[model samples]
Target: MTIESVLSNNRIIAATQLKDIKRADESQCCAMILMNGKLSELMHMPMVHKPLFIHMDLLKGLKNDKEGIAFLKEFINPTGIVTTKGNLIEAAKKEGLLTIQRIFLIDTNSLKTAIQNIKDYRPDAIEVMPGIAPKIVKALKQELDIPIILAGLITTKEDVLHAFEAGAEAVSLSNQLLWNGTTEAITTK
Candidate 1:
């Protein structure tokens, strides 16, 4: 499925360990984001039916550079990549892989820098961390046209609801409990 379809259809994406990949695949989550993995682990990663995205910054033994992205495209071959670097996003775009720019909003300066970088690079999507802030999500939605994926520090069902209410296109979390059955329950509500 296309990235847009994955994001539009699945409100909750499972960000899980490599060992939990199968669980994520079986869960209701429409996509999987592998956060902590080694280059070797990814090289031997089990096949996942859903869209798989690897956090490039978290991968061990892989440089967050164009060469690393090229290697992933040629071998690991995930549906997309999550990274904090704009140059890598450009490189991933060149390799025809979907890109999600992960931005950590620590303060006003950081947020402004993130916004500027996003506008300059223009990845397919943006993932805002410490995603419990509905007000920030609302502001970001007003600032950018790209799809926003809220992640990090999302601990409750209410957090998910608030994120959607703030105009987030999707919410990604590592909670296995939520991954199993949250979409139908919350979306239907």
Candidate 2:
């Protein structure tokens, strides 16, 4: 399914990097970015009844290759995957797994490279890091047709709103308080 279909009404994803597993399991967000814990542990965790996107960078025992992508799809059984590697994203897509390519806008050069690479990889979605940059978000949105998920350093309601205004399809945040707060706001609206 498309990332837009997965996102649905929820414009915020619960990023479980530093989050307690119990809290993440009870999160109100419709999707969870699993950044910690082993694949075995994650499958057993009482997570919220939502789609889970495994973070490939944090996952162990998986090679970043076609065979590895097949293994992840068959064994891990995640709804999607998050990764910065262009090759992995491409391979994952071929494996019928939704791919969210993480792009860190460290500089103009990095942004340029990401744009070029994304054109080649064409993941299901693009997650721009340091989500605080509305201008960059706007620029990327203008250039790319894929869904955009703003992640990292998103700590407040204003930050989330700003990202949306700047053309981010959604925002991924690790703060549980912000997750609940955003859920309330999204539902109320």
CA RMSD, predictions in order: 1.4, 2.4
The superposed Cα distance between candidate 2 and the true structure at residue 73, in angstroms, equals 1.2
Model 2 weakest lDDT span, ten residues long: 180-189
lDDT measured at residue 27 in model 1 versus the true structure, 0 to 100: 93
Each prediction's TM-score versus the true structure? 0.95, 0.89
- The lDDT values for all models are 0.87, 0.81
Candidate 1: segments with Cα more than 4 A from true spot: none
Residue 89 displacement in candidate 2 (angstroms): 0.8
TM-score of 1: 0.95
The candidate maximizing TM-score is 1
Candidate 1 minimal-lDDT segment of 10 residues: 180-189
Candidate 2 clashes: the total is: 0
For residues 43-113, what per-residue lDDT tens digits would candidate 2 score against the true structure? Answer: 45564467878888887656677787888888767788999998889888888889999989989999999
